[model samples]
Target: MSVTLEKVDLSLKYTAYYKQVKEELFEGSSDILNAQRSKAFQSFVMQGIPTRKNENYKYTNLHPSFSPEFSFAHSKTEKEADLQEIFRCDVPQLNTTLAFVYNGWFSRKSSAIDQLPKGVILDSLESISKQQPELLSRYASLADPEEDPMVAMNTAFAKDGFFVYVPKGVVLENAIQIINLMEGSSDMFTTQRNYIYVEEGAKLQLLLCDHSENQNNYLSNSVTEVFVGSNAELEFYMLQNQHNKATNIHSVFVEQQRDSRVTTHTASLHGGLIRNNLKFILDGENCEANMYGMSFLDKKQHVDNFTQVIHAKPHCVSNQLYKNVLDEQSTGAFAGRIHVVRDAQKTNAFQRNNNLLLTDEATMQTKPQLIIDADDVKCSHGATVGQIDEEALFYLRARGLDEGKARLIMMNAFAHEVIQEIKLEPLRERIDELVDKRLKGELARCHDCSYGKDC
Candidate 1:
């Protein structure tokens, strides 16, 4: 029952879907936002889905999974089960304000988000358009698809995701957790568009998790744009844990102001084919940005991480570290770029990528790039791909430890650098447990759809 569409036909299908949403579902939206959507759709039509010929997407290919016949979710889907109980987090002592988005549409049926804080606003993108359209005009469609074709596609089809706003001088103690569940009776194409704005002197933390339900094959395209005002802080964490039949293309674009700080940690634990596009623009002086990512792949799964950090102002600092653990015949790729402009003097940037291969068949490709135009800037990058250290393994084995225990110890040490970056202690512990299970092969069964345990 697999249906594949040719390139030209897929383009026409997307164009038809855009008109249907604009005329029927997205009626009465603000003119400014509507104009933005129209321009985005035009760009998308001009540039169809990207292929391996594109330099940025050379390692990742999207042709094999392009199914235009799949349903495009322009409206809500009826809940098949009680998602509230099935998708709850098992980590103890962690308190968060939960929000749910099912099949690319925000779940208005859930009762978890009945109330919010005084200075904070959390609701569906459709409602925000009717109530606070002016607030979204700036951040919505901020990411241009001309530079990235996939982003343009998302912008063209974006209907609703989440809109979060934090007023100035307010701080939220607990984290805001968003759970995105994809479940349906057939193959479908889903898109999520999210906008987050933090005013000057505000602080917030967010945990974004993606989960797939059912055994159907689907495609998920999501985009998020964030603006951080001067003296504000934002901490973001993303967990990608989907079934093997699912393909996810996710992008995040962040703009930072003077004296602002932003940190993000992305963990790819389970999925079939996953790609993450992360961009950080340091537009003001004395800003700081940190990015950390880890992916554990096995059983022919593929994961790609593309990160770019641009230092446009003086006295800004940026650091990035990405690690990958590949087993069986799994494949992984990392392409990281750090650019410092001409006038950005006193800029400090550092990037590193480390990968571990458990078997000879597992493969990894890494490219760490640095482009500096300023004389006073400090920049460095390095990458290493290899197996476990023989000497270290022998050291542990000599102390009466079994071979399995010794290998697990070394693997833990290799991933500890990126895992330790998690600021929340409880969350860090939860990730540690999962990684431990991953290395021990207990989590290997997640690729099979029949395994119903919480992966």
Candidate 2:
């Protein structure tokens, strides 16, 4: 059966809210800028909204979230104390932080920038658009949504976001962390956009955390673009720990030049329904890309991760590994595609996805594809869907280990491969804690089952 796209039913209140944003576009704004905004608005209206039929969104059903009209929220009732409480509950350390409060507002008071090195630019989208329009035009023009509808939507409605630019030969001494807090109490639709540029020979590390308050049933549409110049290196980490009532559509686009290296680690812990699109293009020779993801879902949470790695130049390498653990009636999906162009000889690409289902009702769909047009290339793809190893569990049990402890150990071990990829010690430990917490919760609900084999 084909799913249908229903237009959102907006109330009179939200209708005025939409008109407000439209008015803000040209409110005392320059004619040239107003014209660009008008063009983008027209494009957005032409595209309308994305639906399940879109190949990238086939596995993720978003109609339920999009059908309801939402207003654009500008503020939240959250105070510093409230934000602090949230930080303590979700993430503890609070070291090296960049924050996007409410929807797209950057909070300098709640963030730390002491560790950033010289020549690194971390500013809001508004400031960048006014101060560095050339850079914005360069990268924004390169953002094409024909491959992913979410990208198109984000660009069309990008009002606020973070921008990072690293000058050539500058190696940041610390990791850049971005925390996005979405409070759904307000009746608004939130959209954010970001542009990141790593100049030649520069090095960078970034962490992105998405969280929301108790309020649920909100929509977050976000897009990020990263450009890595020759000999540059970048490490990116994304964590989704929002309320289960929130719907999220996120996209990340990366372009790598000669001898550059880019690594991305994604962890999706909580969300009502999430659709993630990650794309990497190697445009120069000797470029390298690595992608890793880990997701834990419970209850009715649904998560989908789609990744594409394109080899447009010769002698490029790309590797991907994604693992997921689902409990209750949750669902997880992983779709990875690797493309090697005709002239991209000596391309080395590998992709793998592993899923662990703890309940009979839990479901996972994994698809790995490799399209090679070159003869001299090394490419492989694989996927596995299963539960814990019974024999391994039995051996642990025979060693006098309790069933719960044994299960936790095995689950941790299953997630260790991806966790080990995190080079930052503090971040790695934080991820470990989250993994353990999830496993403990799973163990508490588990009934009589030998290594989850019977389920």
Candidate 3:
């Protein structure tokens, strides 16, 4: 009875809060963004936060994560800070155009805005929407807010997030890195709505890093929409490292045009109750989309990764690979769905989910689904969940290495396939080092973002 009461209260609380703050939520938001709020709020009221009853979220229970008392108002009003000096990337020779989003708002002190190529734009959604309202409105809701309650809630509450635009034929030389840092004195909730558009013949590489300055029980819901124009190429990477008191929810929607290519890598180093929703739509023929993800979880941490790939055009190709290493009492889940429509003949899609359990207490659930209306398409999916291969471990121990070293070696070899898929040389090396430290039962350091500059 208490559980049911808590669930009902959570829904009613947020709904009443929205009704009270509806006017304030529109104060500084873009007109386009505000125009969607009423409908989005209605959807959120209809669908509340997804529970285990939802097929897409069957393995993860989100009640405790959302039951906490969190303030939706921003308590700090500081305009800018020396964020670079505070959260510097320690990987030597890893140069990137850097931007920062402090407490869900794009910082005014980013150095990358001016360094970007001519005709490239990197600014906040509200700021850019005033100038490019048509562009933002066209692609902002590509993922469809009505389909996902989380998307609806973010659409209702989001006021600002970064907007990235690469003009037609323009190519970015340096990868653009956006660091989202959450810091506050009280338990808080944050939302971000971001958009990325790469025009025809353009090329872009983007890195997003999520980190929390302190463990203040932060909850953040973010949504990003991307459009890859014909003949364009995009490489996107995400590094999530936060304290165990934080809850991070991220949903990304990407649409690819003819002959466009996209590759994404997500490394979940640490977090508490992290959920990632990725949807890719191959809208044009000959388009290619690839996704790779790896996570190392320990303690009571929970991570859920859900993906949907829609092969809407003929002759499109898609691939997905996800792996997780769980230890202690940690739990994880992965649900990958591939949809091929009737007109999507000659489509090719493959997906695999593999997990390793270091302790008996660790648990993982994987579901791979294929819904096809075209009988001519080639699609396959597989999932595996188990402990380390005893034979491989024994063979390594027989090679004269200590037991600890041998176990670490096997874990590294198990994760090598996905690590090698990273095309960014320096980033790959850094990720390799982080994973090595994690397997060794030491702090991964995560690009030293949490430590002071000296470390």
- TM-score list, all predictions: 0.93, 0.88, 0.96
- In candidate 2, position 234 carries an lDDT of 96
Cα error, candidate 1, residue 101 (Å): 1.1
Q: Per-residue lDDT for 263-315 in model 2, tens only? A: 99998877788888899999999999999998888989999999999999999
User: Which pairs of residues have clashing backbones in candidate 3?
Assistant: none
Error of 3 at 252 (Å): 0.7
Compare the candidates by TM-score and give the number of the best one: 3
lDDT of 3 by residue, 225-287 (tens): 999999999999988877788899999999999999999899998788899999999999999
Task: Report lDDT (Cα) of residue 278, candidate 3.
Answer: 97
User: Worst ten-residue run, lDDT, model 2?
Assistant: 446-455
**Tens digits of lDDT, candidate 1, 94-176:** 78888888899877675256566796987788778768788877553558888887888887677788888888878888888
Each candidate's root-mean-square deviation in Å?
3.2, 5.8, 2.0
- From the highest TM-score down, the ranking of the candidates is 3, 1, 2
> Which candidate order results from sorting by lDDT in descending order?
3, 1, 2
